[model samples]
Target: MHSLPESKKNHLWRKLVWHTDTDLHPLGPFHLAEVYCCDESNGYAIWYVRRLAKDDARGVAGVENADYLLQYFSKNHRDAAIERAVMLANADPSADKVIAALDRLAGGAQKVSADR
Candidate 1:
């Protein structure tokens, strides 16, 4: 739909810089990037991306690049991706009481994943 403002994009870029360089063990960092981008907006925005992605791939038969989320996450992980995404999103400052909530979730996720 609408292009995000440069300022907003810049902010997101800065926030993501730390994560972009992480080693791709489970998956590459770009998938995480896509998930972060998709989560930046509300539910309606995610729906719009999905709808457009579907439309964009209507003509393609076998190539799996049609689904926006799938395409976005192709470079990284698929399983538990949404869960990780939700955890990352909670780190957004706009979420009230986000610091405590995000810390808990992030810490918990790290612990869980560490044992894997």
Candidate 2:
């Protein structure tokens, strides 16, 4: 998580570390996920994707206005939790349908805000 801007670096790293240690590698060897999550607050997520041949060359990566976006999460912790859930869901191939449903909900929120 070193590559993210200074503000995001620590929090992302903590999440990655916590998720890796607590969820993925409860009792076994340190998996690639742990390694990637540990150092991937930056582009390391992309790096892992490439290494694992999961890189979608056509898809966009990276965060937008990282500081501003993270500030919103910091102020609303539950929103941050939702964001993480989206990330996890997006990672699962079987969950694409669920992810799409969540996206529709998110899109509706955008529409409501835009109408304000």
Candidate 3:
């Protein structure tokens, strides 16, 4: 809903950077967020709740999957990508802990991703 300051966007914004090689390199099974590739076919964020021991191509296909938490797309644009991430975190039962981590990202990033 709001824009983050340049400094904060650089530091707090946990983005998945683009890579030319392995699509999986930037996002293994453990990453919280990866760069939203503008060029990629799958326009969504991969949220992993657990560490992926191996690259399970089958993916977290079921609701019973405890490792793969969610996959989503944010049509609002760039910063919105992280926004969707926050929403997912907040929805989690461990919202307090997850929110704390996101808050820390803001601190380390020197900015918060709006109060929402």
Q: Which tens-of-lDDT digit does each residue in 7-108 have in candidate 3? A: 344332333221123465655334332222221234434343322223322222221213232334544464555666656445444533453343333332
Judge candidate 3 against the unseen true structure and give its global Cα lDDT, from 0 to 1.
0.36
RMSD per prediction, one decimal? 16.8, 12.9, 14.6
lDDT for each of the candidates? 0.30, 0.29, 0.36
Given candidate 2, what's the lDDT at residue 17?
A: 15
Q: Candidate 1 or 2, higher TM-score?
A: 2
What TM-score does candidate 1 reach?
0.21
- Please tell me which predicted candidate would have the highest TM-score against the true structure: 3
After superposition, candidate 1 runs with Cα above 4 Å error: 1-80, 87-93, 109-116
Clash count in backbone of candidate 2: 3
lDDT of 2: 0.29
TM of each candidate vs. truth = 0.21, 0.25, 0.27
- Model 3 misplaced regions, further than 4 Å: 1-42, 52-69, 74-76, 91-116
lDDT of 1 by residue, 10-113 (tens): 22212221222335444542321122333233221111011112223232233222113321233244334444455554555443233233333333232211
